[model samples]
Target: MIDKVVEVVSPERALRREAARRTLRVLNSGYGNHGASRTKKSLIGWNHKGGSPDDDITDNLEVLRQRSRDLYMGGPLATGALKTLRTNVVGYGLRVKPQIDADFLGMSDEEADEWERHVEREFQLWAEDCDAGRMLDFYEMQALVFLSMLMSGDVFCTMPMIERPGNPYALKIAVIEADRVCNPPGVTSPNIRGGIEVDQFGAPIAYYIAQKHPLDSKSMQNKWARVPVFGERTGRRNVLHLMEFERPGQRRGVPILAPVIESLKQLTRYSEAELMAAVVSGMFTVFITSKTPETPLGEAVPLEQQVDVTDENSYELGNGAIIALGEGEDVKEVNPARPNTAFDSFVMSMTRQIGAALEIPYEVLVKHFTASYSASRAALLEAWKMFRMRRSWLISKFCKPIYNEFLYEAVARGRINAPGFFDDPIIRAAYSNAEWYGPSQGQIDPLKEVNAAKIRVQEGFSTRAREATELTGSDFEMIVRQRTKEEKMMREGGLLTNASENQEVLGVPGVENEE
Candidate 1:
């Protein structure tokens, strides 16, 4: 073998190499305490699997939906939260206000106004009779749809055109509950998750809907209908899938109460326990014990004779009853200390947390406005922001699509006058531009609110119509017309006075800014 010459490293280089190795070890360990495994008591068993969005949500969806529904039915807080959202988000119904683009259509202001009025009236006519079951109008259906979404996480709506003698429009709304939409038994596909079939890009292609609810005992639940996302003939969407997506590729919705189901259940249990303790304390029964083998009080009845105490060795306390015990038997007065001093504080704290999760201020959520006027107004304004956001979402997803379809059919049927609606997409969209108005935010201090609204209009920050809509849910045009008629009557009868116009009625004056 050839002589091997060993190249020895310098002392400084060796120390640098050792230091580099130590750095690498530290880097390999992880970025922080949370990123590394630890045997500490708080983190020793924290082994939860991280999953894809669909894998995490779709897999656990059913149980989550069930628990959410159960909580809504049984828990007071859940019911209140659901009701609050339903009331604020879809109160009454979202009424449509046609906003046709007059400039593009080459129409005068008067022409546009007339056209809008005609369209609104026609839409209302169709909406009144649009329900498939012939029970609820479009406005009422909005509430049902909202409540269903709150309860079931999502709701599906189908608009099927069916001929009716009295109703001019054939469009009708048929609401499908969430339970009826599911993956059919014995059917499996890589593109399908939670009954929604998607393409390679994760866009929904179709939905599989069962003929009956899975839990319905009288019907066959396994039968499913595969509905394509768009109609094969007209290229219009056949089904309206109303769901708020929370993930990039999520195919389904999580229940509104999903995040706080456990909390709601625990709070409900605590409330019930407290109520029961208070009730028991109010019974106020007296028990007598004696060393001798006789009733301490002659009028007292024996515990065994009064109640069957064999179950768990428990005694029932009755109203105005004196219980007696035998010799050597003693009863200990275990005070429950009910009407717990901390009950309200604990409950308020828990409610605040839950309300935050639900995006509802505590005052609005519980309908308790005992706070100062500023505090209450702030709570309402905050709640209204969420309400407006949800309303916008509902309008974008549900209202606009339906109205577009309605406009299309109306134009095709020659009910609405439009020259190039079918020929051009731009014309169609311009014709379909509209605003949906729901319940107003409502006033806490009417005088202050009215003054603020007036200032907003005067500063060009808002329009009289918008202020009227937001403040009182009234149309500014209608208010002006009514006011003019009243003034004419007053002038005719010589009842017109400066005081009536200056002070205004109830210290709230009309907005003078033009729309």
Candidate 2:
């Protein structure tokens, strides 16, 4: 029995190893990998197959992005999904809640508090009007970036006003439309790779920004030039190319709607088909003739002139129009009794697929909450997680870098004071340390969720400031300050009880009575 078992297992193991060997061979060839390959096959250096899973995926990205943008801008499901993302993830705007962490710099308590407050105010003012001419603030600029990121694969933000005349901060970020990113004009140098100039390590050294969108009607869209990653005059990072990377060495972002473009197209077709079906189902076809069924004399005139209906003067069945048939052989209504039998079910299924690709819930997409409360809540929570993750990414990638640059400018211009601002990297980091917060995803059941968060804080598992930040995207210190100020004003204005009354009723002078 033991010998027989060995005989069966030995061949199986050999076969498995052989299959793995072939896979490794293909991977090594496709990945352009050399020494990583081994005589004994291994999965460690394996590369993905089909459509060249490589660093040079810019061609695929561009093609998919154009099609994806068309569908998103026009297709119903795509439009709804995008709208849902913007409403839920961005909502009003991702407000900048900067907290200059002087505490991390080991400053005195009083000094830290004052410095943080002062810097916060400075940052806020700067954030209010980021444009050179103040057309849109940083908040509004964020919406454009995210929307373009969804529609196009990536977006570019060039500091065109880094040294503009009359610019206060010596910095101004202009949101370049995503359509402008393209191959550099005229020079086919190998260094210029995939709509961007790159270093030997595949890092983007510069970008080619076009004068006009390729699809724009006014121009043929063939003019572009290489814009440096940093300024020629100052070497400061003048151009910031924002893109979400998936595979290693990818230079540009793949549109978020890329995965579901086909689905959106099909959904649009389905909607049109159902609409046509309903139109066909609405009217009756009338067969008109003379009482004796007047036969065609001989040579047939045009088919339209052959049929002599009394009310042939365009029976346009619209709003209040009615069709009156002549004394005919018969008047038969050819209305389809069943209109779009599979419409509801099909739309639900396809939209669910689309929602999954868009990282939104089907219920959210259609605004249908027929499902159980628990199920609906679960779907919402899952979608909210994706939104929260994306928001964090946005803040980290774009907001943090921009804020750091703004801080440097602020320090340079004597707007904010830092004891060791230009000295040690640690102090510089502490000075630059700030949190960028957006809108929070408030819980479905606020009472229950708030209670849980309260418990978490009381148990020392979390901090009140962190909890407050998560709930409202505002610092707890700032919140408390505002609350204290409001309470003082209200008490002074005779709208609230004194501290004694608050303590007697709520057991805490700082606590407020609920209305």
Candidate 3:
């Protein structure tokens, strides 16, 4: 028991020791217990850093855009995603219907209706000839903008008033691709992010647009123009930037394929590999065995004279050919077992995950709806929800703004009348309000869908207008008018005798049989 010495620890060392112990204990508990545990083999090398949305997007924007375009061009799934969106979201492009506010303009219902019709006609006249290049109409331009945004992450349009021959409206829309908008060389500022200059509150102030696309000519790439957000005198939007924001401060749009890029690429590679394997496996060759070269392998029989032999050791396989083997060489049978038995299941599993990421259901993405009726209908309904959301976004980001500008120009030129549109913001918004229609969600079972729609309308759960629009993408009033005209025509032609008879022929409800 003689000379035991007690060592004293300093307060700083004691505190440090205690803190380390506590940190380890915390790491071994709760979500961090496994997820944040560095001691585990799985998560030992897992490391991630956090950054603002702009930092994450702008830092890798170029690579992201190029890769997305490549995948769209090369990958079938990527192509399907793009085409599906275009077909559902902007099929034949969105047709605009003016919804002017009657109360605000102090006009009766009839007056408002008449005014809206006039506005629509005038708008169409300008819209048909709105393209600056005169190549595409406004509707086709909508498809271009939608596709550009999906492919390039963002698109820019300059609404410059140009007096072109044979075009009544001076407003011409010139579509610009994403590469045209960029940070000018040797111009760096705290306010600029990806050529979009924003104010302190993160609102866009202006954009720097190059005269020519970067890929077009290197010499013209440096020629840039600083276009302000609005006209100086009129305060109208001069540039329309179509992008969907993921984060508040994000100035640039991420491509639609950004989130699923890696998955799509890997899937494409896997598909190509599988396809190559299947093709290779389909050769069905039968190799001959020989014990001695002198024994002589059977002569390479030509199926016809069309077969060309390039190698002595190899011969072309025929429909039903017998071959003899040389002595002392045994045939070693090989089976690649390609066209992998698990290929379809594995691909579908991966596709489901990718479709989920892209907000597309597996059935819709692959156009495979072999499931039960309920299941197929559910998938369609889910896909329609996403399509509708994207359609709404298109309306807000691209369609409405351009239409508002066109309407303003039309009003200024005395083509359409809008009272107090310029003086009050509310009135201006009302006059600019519109309903955009696109292709409808097609039916699987028309009879069932029609009956359900009928019941919904009769029960007051939905309106005929809403049902008609949802089922057929047709105006309810227009349908009603057309049906009335057809019935009158049929009556005049003796195809219809009475209302009950007509109802019986058409299978319409609310018809009583005459005794």
Best by lDDT: 3
**Error in Å for residue 409 of model 3:** 1.0
The lDDT of model 2 is 0.72
TM-score per model over all chains: 0.85, 0.77, 0.85
| lDDT by residue (tens digit), candidate 2, 304-353 | 54445454333333334343444433444565654867789988898888
- Tens-digit lDDT track of model 3 for 1-515: 11121114365666666688777764666666667675678887777677987789987899999999999999999999998888889988788888887887788999998988888788889889999988999999988999999999999999988998877789989999998898888877978879999998989989999887777744732588999998899788889999988888899999999999999999999999999888878876445566576655665576464366655565555657665654565666656789799999999999999999989999999999999999999999999999999999999988888888888888888888887878889989988888888888978899999999999988999998889888898988778888879877887899877778888765668875342
- Model 2 sits at a Cα RMSD from the real structure of 9.3
Q: State how far residue 28 of model 3 sits from its true place (Å).
A: 6.5
Clashing pairs in 3: 290-326, 290-327, 290-329, 291-326, 291-327, 291-328, 291-329, 292-327
lDDT of 1 by residue, 141-220 (tens): 88888888877788899999888998789999899988888888876788887899999899888999987788778874
The whole-model lDDT of each prediction reads 0.83, 0.72, 0.85
Higher-lDDT candidate of 1 and 3: 3
Which residues of candidate 3, in runs, are more than 4 Å off? 1-31, 34-40, 217-221, 284-334, 502-515
lDDT preference between candidates 2 and 3, better one: 3
Residue pairs clashing, model 2? none
Candidate 1 vs candidate 2: which has greater TM-score? 1
